[model samples]
Target: MNAGALVLVVVQVAVMVVLSPLLVGVMRQVRARMEGRAGAGVLQPWRDLRKLLGKETLQADGTSWVMAAGPVVLLGSSALVCALVPLVGTTTFPLVPDDLFVVVSVLLLGTVALALVGLDAGSAFGGMGSSRHMTIAALVEPTVLVSVYALSIPVGSSALSAIVEARIADPASIASPVSLLALVALSVAVLAETGRMPVDNPSTHLELTMIHEAMVLESSGRDLAWLELGSWLRLGALLGLVGSLLVPWGIAGDVTVPALAVGVLALALKLGVIGAGLAAGEVFLAKLRLFRVPELLAGSFVLAFLAVTASYLVVQG
Candidate 1:
């Protein structure tokens, strides 16, 4: 409600929209170079979006309004997430604090919207993808909550902005066992939730192997554009969350023009570094089998549980 928070919200949304596609392109370029291929430039995702937006959208018969509504819902939810999560600044919204549960719920809204869109498509691949997507979602969401809850323990607040601010205030806590364990757990969950390697391949279309791609086979034109952009924003924002939590530096505690400018640069740097690292790491990895993904997620859950226990023990000690 204050000027700082209002300005930060606008800035967060604008930066997420503008940076997400570029982040995706950077990841792709990284992977391409690793694989010894001529890479599409970092501006490629923007080019693709422009092309998709200009094409006509097609819908099949007997599909409900979900076909039309789902993409909008997904994109809207992702944009809201960018606005709510303190990606570049720590100014908290008066009405809706950046609580971990609230952020995860908004993310779930987008996930559900995408699943419904897949189911509405009425193809075998779509149904299969939806089932798989929901299965992963069921596992990933709990890890996200529990891991972030661990981070919230020391600060005694679930608001992400507060947690980040606390980390900035106390640099030593960033190196604590609780913080490291929880961050690792959350990072794995982020990879799974965003359709990254070892969970789902963002670039693959092999019918038996694809999860996110299978669901979107039926969408075209602007519909597809919305879906792609929404997914990219989710990835960008979650990566920003990880970056902010892992290194809570340069985020403006009190929003000023100079501070905001520094925050934006810091965020862009973090996203690029993390995206490139992820891509480079994925080069040496293979997508896990659908059945094996549960084990990986379950392992992350155990890490989160340990982090929670460690946090409590540390507090007691």
Candidate 2:
């Protein structure tokens, strides 16, 4: 990579790492305020992570190499995505694989790593979390895969850079019915993937209602810190994808300071809108019973399928 691209890569990764937790905190604060309680400050997640890093870690009994290795792999995968995603610039890092499929696989790889860690921990809560998480994951995959491909159909390429570049060049590329439906599918995806709102509550300690938290109940100190940071970073990366792929205006297409500043402002605006919507939904909607999650995801699957069909029909007609 040239010096400019290298700088952007570092800047984007640092921004993501520093700001992801703030997004989570904002959501929490907003939800708390809506419920008539004074919320913690938006820097609460930052404070929690800082404290966790200083404390000692405790490992569960009978945990194998998987327990030790899992967080490293999980954090690595999340970091890889932060590096790969087109946050402010419409290009992939040089020498990094540029396909969206590669990006999706890396995401799924993180999920699999977490599942392994949960099983390796040998806690009933961990196993329950793993099973529910995997089940939701399997149902959600088709919607994600199809929605991405549907968005790509207009650009005629699955490369992440190409899709971003195409939409940046042709602003009308996102105005189609396919794009609209695909956006809804992705909206549903954001909730499930981020463990937010009606899908899963991030702040809850209830074992019967939690999916993501249960898996990490045994982690303490630095290990828990990695998981918490990884989760927020993962959400940030995915939200970046939603912005870059669906609403790609104002992203930098070249190495210019002015363009990069515009890109950062644009992304912040988009993520802010998304975070507010999620917080409001949390306040208004009730959590789905576990059995009904599949039904909700199935509806998302149909929307994604329709999005793909609509994209093809637009071309064919």
Superposing all C-alpha atoms, what RMSD in Å does each candidate have to the true structure? 1.1, 1.7
Against the true structure, whose lDDT is highest?
1
- TM-score result, candidate 2: 0.95
Indicate the residue-level lDDT of 213 in model 1: 93
**Pairs of residues clashing in candidate 1:** none
Tell me the tens digit of each residue's lDDT in model 2 across 121-234: 888889998898889888877788888888888878877778888877777777778888998897787678777767887778788787999888888898889888888889
Clash number by candidate, in order: 0, 0
Tens digit of per-residue lDDT, candidate 1, span 30-59:
999999999989999999999999999999
lDDT of 1 at 147: 98
- Give each model's whole-structure lDDT: 0.93, 0.82
Off by over 4 Å in 2: none
Kindly report which residue pairs in candidate 2 clash with one another: none
TM-score of 1: 0.98
